[model samples]
Target: MKYLGIILSAIGLMIIINSCSKSWTDYSALQVQNLNQDSNTALNNKTYQTYLANLRSYKSSKHSIVMGWIEWGDKTSTANSTLNDLPDSLDFISILNPSNTLSDEKKQDLSSVQKNKGTKVLYNLNLQNWDDSLYSTFNKIGYLLNVDSAFQSQLDSVILAINSLGYDGVDVNVEGMNCSSCGSFFYTYQTGYYNRILDTLGKLYGPHSNTEKFLLVEGATTASLLSGTESYFNYYIANTNDYSWYYQVDNAYATIAQIPGFTNDKLIITTDFNDKSVSADISDKLWQYGGIPFYTNGSGTPIPSSTALLNWNPTSGLKGGMGIFYINYDYFNNDFTITKNIIKTLNPSGE
Candidate 1:
C-alpha cells in the first residue's frame, strides 16, 4: 500500500508540471505574436511619417511636383494647354527651346493660362540673348553670367524685362558647361560664381509668394555639383542618367543624401526613358535617392519607354514623384494615351 501511494503521488506531480509547462508555452507564443504586430505597425508608421514630412515641407503641396517642358511648335499660342492637360497631373511647366522673342504681352498671356490651375510657368532662356545683336552661341552666358561685371548691365535689362512679364520665375540652361572658355576661373577664382546669375535673378524677380523665389539651373556640370554651387539654386538638374552601372542606385543615394547631403526635395535626377534597356527600374532607383525624378523622351519617340509616368509604391520611404522631359513631345504621337497611362501607373493613380 505504501509503495502504491508513493507511485500515485509521483504521477500527480508529473501531471501538474506538464500542465504548467504547456501554459507557459502558450503565453510565450502570444507574447511573440504581439511583438510582431507592434513591429509591423511601427514600420508602417515610419513610412507614413516620411510621406507626411515631405508633404508638409512643401506646405500641403502634393508630395510630388509633376513638371514638363512646353516647346514653341507644340502649342497653339503661348499658353496653349492641349499637350499640358493630357494627364491633368502637372505642377510645373516651363516654355523651352527659347526663341528669344518674348514680348511683354506674350509673357502676360502665358502667365494667365497656367495660373488658372496654379501651375508655375517660368521664363526659360538659353545662352541665346533675346537682344539678338548681342547674341553669340554661348557668348551671352560667358559674358553676362561670369564672375565679373562684364555683363551686369545687360543682365539687369534682361531681368527688368522678364520681371515685367510677370513670370513665376526663370529656368536658365548652361549648355557646354564644361566648355573650354567656362574657364578655370569658375573653379579657381570664386565659389559658385555661376550662381551669381541665379541669385541676381531671384532677388530681382522674386520672393514669389507661391514658388518662394523660384530659379532652376539645368545641365549642371560635375564641377558645379561638387563645388556646391548647386545648393544655391532652387533645383539642380543633374545629367547622371546612366542606370547601367551596377551600383548606380546606391552611389546616387550616397552621393546626394549621404555625402553632400541633399534630399530628393532638392535634387532633380534625369533618366533616359527612351532607352529600352532602362524602363520601369529607373523611377525606383531614383526614388530611393529621395529627390524629384524626371525622365526624357526626345522628339522622335512620343512613346515613353516605360509607358508609365512613375513606378513608386512607398512602403517604407518617400517617393517625391517624377515628371517628364518635354510635354510637347507627346504631340508627335498625336495623342497622350501613352503619357496618360504612365502618369496613372504606380502613381497616386497607381496600377
Candidate 2:
C-alpha cells in the first residue's frame, strides 16, 4: 500500500510539470509573433519615411509644381474639405478665407501637411475682401498705400497676421488695378503704390528673400502691370477664367514671360473648374511654353475639352507643373480624381 501511494504522488508531480511546460511553450510562441509584428511595423515606418523624403526632394527639384486654391473649412468632418485630406503631392496650397481664428484642430492639420508633406501653405490676400465696394476704384489694395491715414497699416496687419498664423507666404489678388474713370495718371500712381505694397511683402517672402517663403500675385488684368515688381513674386498665376480661346492664354503667358524678371518657370496658367465647358487644350500649349498648366476638370474620361488635360504632356522634356482651382470640389466626386491624375501624369511613380 505505501508503494502504491508513492506511485500516485509521482504521477501527480509529472502532470504538474507537463502543464507548466505547455504553458511556457505557448508563451514562447506568442513572444515570437509579437517580435515579427514589431519588425514589420519598423520596416513599414522606414519605407514611409523614405517616401516622404523622396516627395520633398521632388518638390525642391526643378520639376513643374502643382498648386491649388482650397477653401479653409475648419471642420474635418467632411471628406475633402480639410487640409489634412489633401493629396500629399501638392507643392503649394493657397488657403482661401484663412483667418487668425483657426481652431486647434485646423492648425494641427495645416502644420501636419507642411512638416510631413513638404507642402507650402499660403494665405489668400484678396483685396476685394477688404471692401468690395472699393474694388472698382484705386481704393482697394491701393488704399493700403496711398489713401489710408495710417501708412501701410493695413499691409502691416496682413504681414503680422500671416507671420503669427504660421503661413508660408501670401497670394496677393492684384485684380481691380484697372480703372477707366480714374484716368492714366491716377492709374499709374495706383500701380506704383500697389507695387510698393508688393515690394514690402516680397522683401520677406520673395524668391530672393532669405526665408523659404513665396510671394505670388494673381488677378492682374495685364502682366505688363507687373513689369517692375515681377522679381518680387515667385509665380504670376494668370487668372484666365474669362478667356475662352487658347490664344488668350497664350497672350497672357507671352505677356508675363515678356516681363523682365518673369520666365516660363514663374508662370502658372489656370482654368476655372467652375466652368466645365472651358477647353483644357491650352494645357498642351502651356507645355510648349514650359509653363505649368492648372485645370479644374475631374471627370476621369478625356472629352475634347474635359479632363483630357491629364492624358497629355510634353514628350521631350518635363513641362512646368499643373494646378487646380477649387480643388476641394474635385474631392466630392472621387477623392481628388483630376488632381491626382495630373500629378501622377506629370511625376509618375515609376520615375
Candidate 3:
C-alpha cells in the first residue's frame, strides 16, 4: 500500500512538471519575439535619426537649394494641398499667406515638415496687390513703412511675429516701386526706409548672421535700393518678366552681379509657370548664370520649362538652385511629379 501511494505521488509530480515546462517554453518564446521587435524598432529609429542629421548637414553645405512658394490651405481640403504633402527633399518654402489665421491643423502640418524634413519655412511678406484677408498684417506694415514715420514699430512687430510663430525666415517681395506720380524725395525716402528694414532684418537673419534664418528679397533691384543692403539678403530673386531670351537673362545676371555686395550665387532667375508661352530653353539657361530657375507665370509651357530647368546644369559648377511660384499647382494625379523631379535633379542622391 505504501509503495502504491508513493508511485501515484511521483506520477502526479511528473504531470505537474511537464505542464510547467510547457508554459515556461511558451513564455520564453514570447519574450524572444518581443525582444526582436524591440531591437528592430530601435534600429529603425537610429536609421531615421541618421537620415535627418545627414539632411541638415546637406542643407548647411555649399550645395544649391530648391525653393517653392505654396499657398497655405487645410490639409484635409484635397490631396497635395498641405505642407506635409510637399516633396521631402525641398530645401525651402515660402508660405504665400502665412498669418495668425492659420488653423491648428495647418500649423501642425508646418511644424511636422520642418521637424521631420529639413525644409526651411519662410514667411511671405508681399507688399503689392495682396489679399487683405490673407496678408492684412504685412500689407499694413508695408503701408506704414511707406508713409508712417513710426514704421519702426511695425517692423518690430514683423520680427516678433516671425519669432513667435516659429518661422525659419522671411521673403520680402516689394513690387511697383516705380511710382510715376511720386516725386524724387518720396522715392528716396521710401528707398531708405526699405533699406533700414532690410538692414535690421539682416542683423538678425542674413546669411552671414549667427542665426540659421534666411533673409530673401525681390523687386528691390535698383542700385540705390540694393547697394548697401545687398549683403543683408541671402538671395536677390531677379525679376523674370523680361527674361524671354538667353541674352536677357545673361544681361540681367551681369547687371545684378555688378552690385557692390551682390554675388552670382545670390541671384535667382524666375520664370512664370502660368505663362505657357515662355520657352523652356530660357529656363534651362538659368543654370549658366549660377542661379536657380524660378517659375513665375502660367500661360502654357510649364512641363517643358520645368523639365528643362531641373535637368540642365552648368558645366562650370552646380547652379544656385531652382524655385516654383505656385508649387501646389504642380501636384497633379495625386503626386508632386515636377517638384520631385526638380529635387531629384538638383540632388541626385535621394534624400
Give the worst 10-residue stretch by lDDT in candidate 1: 1-10
Off by over 4 Å in 2: 1-44, 131-146, 178-188, 275-319, 349-351
TM-score of each model, paired residue for residue:
0.54, 0.70, 0.68
- Candidate 3 regions with alpha-carbon error over 4 angstroms: 1-50, 129-146, 176-185, 274-303, 308-318, 349-351
> Whole-model Cα lDDT per candidate?
0.42, 0.58, 0.57
Candidate 3 global CA lDDT score: 0.57
Off by over 4 Å in 1: 1-60, 74-87, 99-109, 125-147, 174-192, 202-211, 219-233, 240-253, 258-261, 271-309, 312-316, 349-351
What digit string (tens of lDDT, one per residue) describes model 3 on residues 1-351? 111011111221222222211211111111221222254542245434454455556666666677878777774445556765666557788887667455677667767668755679998876543222222333334754435434566567778878887889898886535444444544556566667777788887868678989888876455566647767878877665444334445565666667767665666655444423334555533222223343334343333445544444333444567777767666552355556656655555432
Q: Candidate 3: deviation at residue 150, Å?
A: 5.8
- Write model 1 residue lDDT over 1-351, tens digit each, in one string: 111011111221222222212211111111221222254542234432342233233323434455666653432432223323333344456666544456444444454334323456666765433223333333434753432554465566556655665666777665334334444533353334445665566554433223454776555443343353344456645444444332444355444454243456555544432312223544432222222233333333222323322442223354444445555444334343334444444233221
Writing each residue's lDDT as its tens digit, candidate 2 over 1-351 gives 111011111221222223211211111111221222254542245434454565566677666677888777755456566765667667889987778667776777777668756789998987645532333434555654454433266678888988988899999887754443455544545556677777788888978678988888886445555647777888877775444444565566666666775556666655445424333554343222222333334424223222333333333333355566777666654555566656655554312
Best by lDDT: 2
Q: What is the Å distance of residue 111 in model 2 from its true position?
A: 0.9
RMSD of 3: 16.7
Instruction: Output the better candidate (1/2) by TM-score.
Output: 2
